[model samples]
Target: MSSHQPPRPVRFGILGCASIARKLARAMLLAPGAAVAAVGSRSEEKARLFAADNGLDVATTRLHGTYEAVLDDPDVDVVYLPLPTSLHVRWATAAAARGKHLLLEKPTALCAADLDAILAACDAAGVQFMDSTMWMHHPRTAKMRELVDDKDAIGDIKVINSVFCFRANEDFLQNDIRVKPDLDALGALGDVGWYCIRAILWAVDYELPKTVIALRDPVKNQSGVLLACGATLYWADGKTATFSCSFLTNLTMDITLVGTNGTLHVTDFVIPYEEKSAEFSVASKSNFAQLHIGWDPLPSKHVVTTDLPQEALMVQELARLVQNIRDAGGKPEGKWPAITRKTQVVLDAVKTSIDKGSEPVEIAN
Candidate 1:
């Protein structure tokens, strides 16, 4: 037999016990390189309940009554923060100051400026910083990215349209933290539009668009939180993209990319319909058959499979990076934080365009 040893699992401290945190805790269990070491909330009882409800053993896991306690825990190697958008800057910087690697939830902050402060702190502390955009870690996303980059596969992308929407029940509409002005504020745009904007940017190799224009109409709640909206982005090279996001419609996570020589379509871009596999359709070299009764080329579907869910994959990646920093004296990966900044920058642009009454906003290079 070989004399190799198993890798040490990265210890994770979860803060706030947000609804999303439960799913992330499960994801941590799914990743071989990660483990939940502690959980903290304003109420120690709440944290205890969360741990119990989530099947975390109280004897092995520490439960704290305050967010600071979790950050101060020496056993915690990384902090999984799924807190509200507004609270990101304060807590994220605090975590970094304590030398804890951060796995922040998406919509990293309410605005780009806030995110900058958080990033600056992480930089100073030399700690890992990554946003929880789970789908980005999916194997299917890599396959799609490879296909788009291969000129022979789909040629150059000319246009893209993406949407992430789902209807919310009355209770959620009235009381969910996402709809609260002081909590999420950005609402549907932050909740769903984030995925769309990321997809558009990824299609163009993360190039910032030349301009962004918000759609004419957007639905907002009484507190002025966005509930539905759309925006279009223009690249200097003539490539264009549009995306829609909403909480007023049936569930739909779709993306369509039209290229010079071919096209691609994915119905579930954010969350795949099934856990084991995901699919996308592609068409190339279209020509009419004799008599033009039907198209000569038909789109074909490609399915990509993964043993672990995308969220688990995300945790695994962060764990691997954190391990390197902790054990091998390696620096944190810059790619994740860099891409996260780009996503936030683009998001701020869309919000600005909307606030300016749909006037096109120029994106600074």
Candidate 2:
């Protein structure tokens, strides 16, 4: 809907009592066209406590112990899931069957096939679905795209390198979701590497690589803690992209796109906090004059910061969904921002490559 007037707020039902849900609840309060009307948790007591704490214990407010109950609510136009990765497919499917739009966390499903199922279900139900890949929506990332498309900046993309790692808590073994068996199995690739892959996907306009090679060195159980892993992606355009993700390694959060004319470097690529500034730079391979005449030379340096908090991205994503729903007569297209079948295809290829000793796996066209 073309709206100079504000759209009606989208009432949301959140599944799970995830830490991220709290942030989303706060964000929903701040978001212009969204409202958290209900929350569901496995534990009735927990749901009650959270609802009371959030001042949602009012007579009209809804809070329930089971996620299914949240999905059954007629008031909820969309459901935001912050559940564990394994539970994604089941919950997402159920939500879609109930005709509720879905906002899933990153790395939407275990593999591409599962994501496809989630998308198909949503499509059949005529509801929208999207991964909360908020990084893709930020201005800094948009600027990076501009530089990549610039002929003088990086003429023909040749390679990409990215790393996102942080040492786990020493007592991670004691008990933590990150180290849990199933999640650990997904390893760093699904956890953080996915961001790097998706970033490159967006940069290259979602071109699927022709070949992929992955290596996973599990330091522990079947779900080995991804001490370190590397991937080699061969694209049809003779461009090769590679990235490493680790939890046992030193701190690192960076993505560098190397092209023919110049290289674009992005630090803190994935989590561009509104309060914290991210650094971006592009050094042209062409002479200073060529850079000036042929293109608007990128600022030698750029910083990303929003007056809002880190949760602002989530807030913005939800707001976009609400606006789309209101404008489209309540039948929004795509999931979240846009859940495509391609996302799952690439993810599946990566999983197969990792399982087969990082053997080069071909992505089906």
Predicted structure with the largest lDDT when compared to the true one: 1
**Model 2, residue pairs in steric clash:** 1-327, 112-344, 129-335, 129-336, 130-335, 130-336, 214-358, 274-306
- Residue-by-residue lDDT tens digits, candidate 2, 55-95: 56446557788999999999887898998888888999999
Off by over 4 Å in 1: 1-3
Worst 10 residues of 2 by lDDT: 332-341
RMSD for all candidates, in order, please. 1.5, 4.0
Clashes of each: 0, 8
Scored by Cα lDDT, where does model 1 land? 0.93
Candidate 1 lands at a TM-score of 0.98
